[model samples]
Target: MSATRPGSVTFVAVLVYINGVLNIIGGVVILFTRDQMVRASNAGAIAGITTAAILSIVLGIVILIVARGLLSGSRLARGLVTVVMILNAVSGVILLFNFQFFSGILEILWAVVVMYLLFTQRANAFFASRA
Candidate 1:
């Protein structure tokens, strides 16, 4: 438990922060343009878009909080992030079936890289020391 903080942790933290910010922004944008999306998709009601926007914003806040915990080397944060990444990867795969090929691939790759970084020897040691 004597190793210094690994670069992987810092890298993941930064990526998480960026992801959080993007999620929030995307949610807001989608919320504001709900009318357009509903019309374009011929979805009639705006209920679905509204729900998605809200969920995105909530997810963003949670991610931001987890990123903060991660920087501090919290074990719970690592677990939480791992779960989130797995969920994201699953969602990405689902999205691929819906024609979101580029984003889906990116999400899966991001999850894999984050998982690899988090479980590395140096990262594990860093978290152990913080405990």
Candidate 2:
């Protein structure tokens, strides 16, 4: 690890790892518990559930790979994570219109804080040093 590696970068990497694990777990749960959902007997419902499960699992795996890249100070990983956060923040705005006031606000704020941490002066120096 570079001596200049920022703590925020490390923290973000860990968070990403956790997020990846959770996504994978959520996907598997959807797969296993699909049968308990309403209208699960319907073939359409089953197919939908299966699709969601597969997508979630695939996303989780990709996130895990991103997390690893971030730990290694890969600029590509940072860019990927930034894009994901931007999308997350956008979702927050969408959530707000759906009557999820608190969740929406939290998500937006979370994204802001994360971006701030990732782009602070010390963090910039740290990443630049790696470059």
Candidate with maximal TM-score? 2
Candidate 2 per-residue C-alpha lDDT over 1-131 given as tens digits, one digit per residue, 9 for 90 to 100: 55467889889989999999999999999999998885756989899989999999999999999999887877788888888789989999999999999999999998888888778887777766678
- Which candidate comes out best when scored by lDDT? 1
Q: Candidate 1, which ten residues in sequence have the lowest lDDT sum?
A: 36-45
Model 2: how far is 55 from its true place, Å?
0.8
Once fitted onto the true fold, the runs of candidate 1 whose alpha carbons sit more than 4 angstroms away are 1-3, 39-44, 88-109
Task: In model 2, state the lDDT of residue 71.
Answer: 77
Off by over 4 Å in 2: 1-3, 38-40, 97-99
Could you tell me the TM-score of candidate 1?
0.76
Stretch of 10 with least lDDT, candidate 2 = 122-131
TM-score (all chains, Cα) for each model: 0.76, 0.87
